[model samples]
Target chain A: MNGLKQHYAKIIVWAILLTIPYWFTYIGGYLGLANEIVIYALAAMALNFLLGFTGVLSFGHAAFFGLGAYGTALTIKFLVPSTLVGLAVGVLTATVAGMVIGALIIKRRGVYFAMATIAFGQLFFFIANRWNSVTGGDDGVGNWHRMPINLGFTTIPLFHNSLVYYYFTLLLFALAVGAMGLLLDGPFGRSLMAIRENERRARFLGINIELHVWISFVISTAICGLAGGMLALLDNFVNPRDLRFDLSGVLVVMAVMGGMRSFWGPLLGAAIFQWLREVLSSHTPNWQTYIGIVFVLVVLFFRRGILGFKLSTVKS
Target chain B: MAQLLLFDISNGLITGAFYALMALGLSMILNLSGVINFAHGGFLTLGAYFAYVLQQKIGFFGALLIAPMITALLGLLVERVLIRPLYGRDPLYSLLLTFGLAFILVDGVRIIWGPGSPPYQVPEWLTSPLSSTYFFLTGYRVFMVVLVVTAVAALFYVLNYTKLGLRIRAGTKDLETLSTLGVNTRILRNLNFGLGIYLAGLAGALAAGFLGLSPALGTALLMPSFVAIIIGGLGSLLGTLLGGLLIGVAVGLTTVFYPAASEAVIYVMLGLVLVLRPRGLLGEEGRLH
Candidate 1:
């Protein structure tokens, strides 16, 4: 019965997501906003791969995410006009960045690790901000959009049609999510969980803690880069803000709000956060305060998140 | 050429002094409470803004002294209400709470201050360069360095000579044992948080005179302090101080030859420091781990 319920949950989630493009407008969200939610959800889930699954706190994921954006943007803007190549370059860039940064901070633990990550994340932001000639600097890299996909005989116009782009993104999201789900169910993911539970015990059990963490960090960043690439494609622009620590913090908040431990929690969290941001920003200028208040409230009271809450009766 | 180098070094030291002031507060809270206090920048901004507002009524010196105290009180209150409960939980919760609070504070400042750089005036004499040959030695810069020295000295005196200081040092080393010794750790943590915030506020007030009163003022200064703490090594106040000074000089020197890489130079220094000394320059082994 439990297995059946889990199966039902997966089906329901996929069903809802598959139909979002159709019903999103009726729910006061545009297709672009839906794409954004999915992309952000992908990034948040990627962050959760480290924060929740591995029990490692990385406030620097934005560096990878931004790298993905800049990589995709710069690639398409200057290097190539192909959307697929742009995305591959974006992910590859984030992967290389993650590998280097992960190796650097592999030995640091707890808050030190988090601090190092934040500082490193800001390094990229500064680089992007200061490297104005190549990066377009603070103004952001613009005047380029995602090109159409040419599958030999057929061409899909990703630039002109938002719906086509949305489906394309959804397909990529499924592949990434599927890969993550498989990894989480496998041995490597189990080792990450062990490290999260107790590093000393995991170390005692002969698990290579640092190696596992570095790998987890790299995987999370690479996935986050994919999300960043999608974001750049969605907007056809990438800015230094993408690499800023604030976005990193926001990604962490999304994971926590949706219940980091739960596999799909960040998706729900991202959806809620994106929808609220859309609605709130339109209604009031002090939307960030409201979002911040939500953050405080979540950390204070709803830390278990929507999925984390349990309805159990206590017998006294 | 020598004069130019000297000018940059002095300028770097000035900025480094500011970083030390802020970093010392951050290191204090991290040592004692195990909280990163991301809202520290927020508090610093608040202090600067408070000074800006108070300067109108009571003048510069009066505002400078009172503004940080108000910010400290607010910090104390926040610790009691928001941070107190999160103690003994995963440090992640406190970090997140503070991170969120930073967001609120930044937005709140924007709402109140109208998102523009407010004109923060020092005395007329302070604005003028004290030496004709050394044009960079503005009276304001010298006065800022003096205040920073005085603040650091006062801080050291309090830590070394006072009972509260004794308890804070003890707590940073071993909060659990400090609590076992019946230190009323609740109050200790609260006061420690307040004291750290007080430094931030003070730094903010002084920083406003140089950087001008903008919402971004705290953020611009925030990353350098983190680098300072990292370079100095965690759990060492003196190390933090040295780290700040080192980075300031590094940045100052870089600006002379490579203006574009000036900001990036400190980070490069941080990388080199991390590689050369992982635990930080003065960080003790197994202190925070």
Candidate 2:
């Protein structure tokens, strides 16, 4: 009975955490601006998989996120007008891109891996920016159709209202978090933790470290892509700026600030970041300085992140 | 054709001189502290901004004298506050920490200075071309080449002859061991980081005359600097100098032949080198952990 109560309590806490976006959307609608915080939160969650669970620190995850956004926009342009299909295509493309890049990059561990990812990401950014004919060259893609969810005979229009899109996003978020949780509880997740702790020992014990890292990279990137597609849909536009190195760097900050070890850390970090952005941008134009200061403090002092520290302390 | 090639080569050499100054500081920091220091580019940006501010208020010469000192002080503060804690941790922590600091610095500049490129004028005294019958070069560019060479030579002298340099070299080999040997490794590490950052600041100030000061220029310069360091091999000043010149020439030649390939050439070179020799051309084998 006590174990069941604990499980219910966990579910309730998650439900409350998930409901925060809905509250923000309702509040944002009344204030007359779209709620962008949710989209960022989703992106942060995707980043958490790599930074939090797996022991890889990426500075170029935004490349995948941006690729996914571009992928969805491209899919919408060429393929049939099914929002689900477009999102799927975006996720698929990002996953493949991540897998291929991961194969080459995962060979170099630690800082080299981080630098290599940044290099490849910059290469993609150049392609996206310079290849203007296809990517619309800096101006970004506009006039793309909003997400349209069709269920058999009835079509659910996703963008007619922000509330509807919020629900849709929330559903997707649930699915992603669920899938990620399942993966973390499985054997692969155990292997990832082992690799993170000691690669040589893991290898000695017969685990293929490279293959596991590559797989994590692929899945994490695909989720990031999905979040990007959703973001493009939310804003009704996509641009090369989405894939900028700064954006990738921001995801890293969010991951670190929220505490990469905790499952819900990214989500909390995203929420706090959104609130911070809104507050700071309103007061001063140079919000990045403030963010930078905070980032330095966190990295220097709060290595475990807030939630991670809290959980650890509680466990103790 | 031969004349044009010679011109390109000379221009490449001049460009390489600036890159060497920038890469040397980065290599020194990495060698001593084991952190990538993403904010190194931000220091360059800060140097340019400081030069711009000083030139407007004081005078061009005064700006040149003061900006690099200010940058070095900032580097010192960063080492003491932000980088000191990561000494015993994995390099990734410092890398991410510095990456965070880079964001803050770049954004801070953007906020204070605004997004648009700040207008800067090259002082009239330094703007003329230096001519030698057959070849003519921008006086400022030649000055840059001379200044960078002098800086590198001075750095070499200091590293080779000074007790401080010996401590830094010894610290890089093993920080704990050095500390146990009663050497003040922390102070040595801070000095190395400060010097590396100061050099970057000087490079930025000089680059402002060549490339023009802008908020986004640092981001663009960062990848090339990294490429130079990677190609030259980490933690070796001589290797970094060679790498910088090689990349500068490669880039200059590519632009001369095929302008489109110029942007991608550094990455391509990196890929080829990584595939052929993963430790980098000058990099020590098994240095990566």
Candidate 3:
């Protein structure tokens, strides 16, 4: 009986997530709040796709996330009013950038790779921050919002109904998450794991380690782009802050704090982190220090993360 | 045009000295302990604040001498308490811990000193302009350059001649062997970390005069230092020193040609270095992998 219940844990977790918006009323939380958590959770999961599974650490992934957001926002404001089209363009642009950068920096591993990503990532941020003409510079482009999703027969009124937008965002998040799951269960995923486990052994066994790392980088950022598109819609604005190293650091911390080794670990991490930030910020102005304290604790004790601990301590 | 170019070059040389000074310390830490000290900028900020406090009482010369040493003591304490245990672990923990430490230090300085820039006074002799034709070449800038040169010379002398430097170099090359040969690796690393922080503190004190005393002092200088190390190549101190000067000059030239891209150009140089020679200009081959 216990084994049967354990097998259905994933379904149970997904159901809980799907119904959170409805039950959020009981906890005095609004739809917008739940939506934000889902968006961050998805973003954290995307980061884990690279950090946890691929065994690569990227310190500046916000470049792609912010790119997707700006692409979506700019496309909607200047090019098209269709949110669907905006999202597609945003993801497409982010993927291309990721492919190019991943190809360039994938030659290095570990800390050097992280440093390279930070440098490359900061380049985009500085451009966005300085190019006031196109990017609107530091204040970020405002007076723009996500358009209603046009489904040919019936338009999804995402702007008016918060619940509708939540479901729509959740649908895309599910698809992105599903894609990652499938990829991780395949031979390519096995190759990535092999490299992470032992690069020397993997190289000797005929795997092109750099190519695999590049692919992982591209794939991870592509999903991050989708989340970024959702994020632009969530906040109705995209700024250089979205592209900053701070957000990249947050995503990595979320992945590690939640359990980098487990698939759902980052989602849990994102929820905990977002909640902690919200609660702490509301209560005290020194929330950043507290967050730093949290980071210190996680590094020192919970390196394996919450799920990692649970898996070891709990019997099925 | 020639005059403007000369002025920028002179200025660039001074800025390059700052980069080389800071990057040398960073390279020392990176070489000896494969950990990227993300809070290095925090140390720089702390050094600046300490000088700000000390200079008010003792004036520039005394504060300049003592502030960095105090910061080094703090660095020693921090390395022992926070950074020591994570030494042999995955480099990720050290990186994250320091990243977190950066937040604490930056915020702590802000809380203690307030967020705005505090008034910084350099000695009048140092601040006076050298010539009406070259008003940009102030005595302070010259002093900064000479001091940097002297410090670099001192560092090289220690590394080449001293028993500590010999042991550090040997340990960096082959730690397992160094440990087997009866050297106290722990003390070596702790002192090395202190020495590295001492340089950061010195750079911070010098920067406070030009940039003004602020909480944000260290972060602004940190990235370019990283670029210098990357451009110079890892493992070779000469590479880092050369890398800092090269980027400093590049930034100076870029300011003249495309002022908007003065900062971005360093990152671009980093990208070029990585793509062209992943090992870096003076970096030992295979250290990157």
Rank the models by DockQ, top first: 1, 3, 2
Error of 2 at B94 (Å): 3.3
Residue B282 error for model 1, in Å? 0.8
Give the C-alpha miss distance for residue A15 in model 1, angstroms. 0.6
How many pairs of residues collide in model 1? 0
Write one digit per residue (lDDT tens) for candidate 2, span A1-316: 1457546755875676556544645554321122455567678878878766777777788889998888888888767567888888888988898987787667777666777777777766777777767878788888777766778898777878666777787778778878987888889888988887778899999999889988998888999999888888777789888998878877877776777777766766776777777778789877778877777777777777766644331110
DockQ of candidate 3 against the true complex: 0.45
- Candidate 1 i-RMS: 5.6
Where does model 3 exceed 4 Å of error?
A1-7, A309-316
How much is A189 displaced in model 3, in angstroms? 1.1
Ranking by TM-score: 1, 3, 2
Q: Write the per-residue lDDT of candidate 1 for residues B109-170, one digit (tens) a residue.
A: 99999899979979898899878899888988988999999999999999999999999999
lDDT of 3 by residue, A170-273 (tens): 89988998888788878998898888777889999999988888898999898898899899998889999998877887888898898887888898888889
lDDT per residue, candidate 2, B1-289, as tens digits?
7666767777777777777777888889888887887888889999989999999898887888799999999999989987887886767668777877887778878878888888877876677765664254667767888888888998988888999988888887778898998988888899999999889889888888888887766667777777787777665678888888898898789767976567678878877777777677788766655
Q: DockQ (C-alpha) of model 2?
A: 0.44
Q: What is candidate 1's lDDT per residue for A64-146, written digit by digit as tens?
A: 99999999999999999899999999999999999988988889888888888888889889899999899988899999999
Per-candidate clash tally: 0, 2, 2
Q: Is candidate 2 or candidate 3 better by lDDT?
A: 3
Q: Could you tell me the lDDT of residue A142 within candidate 3?
A: 81
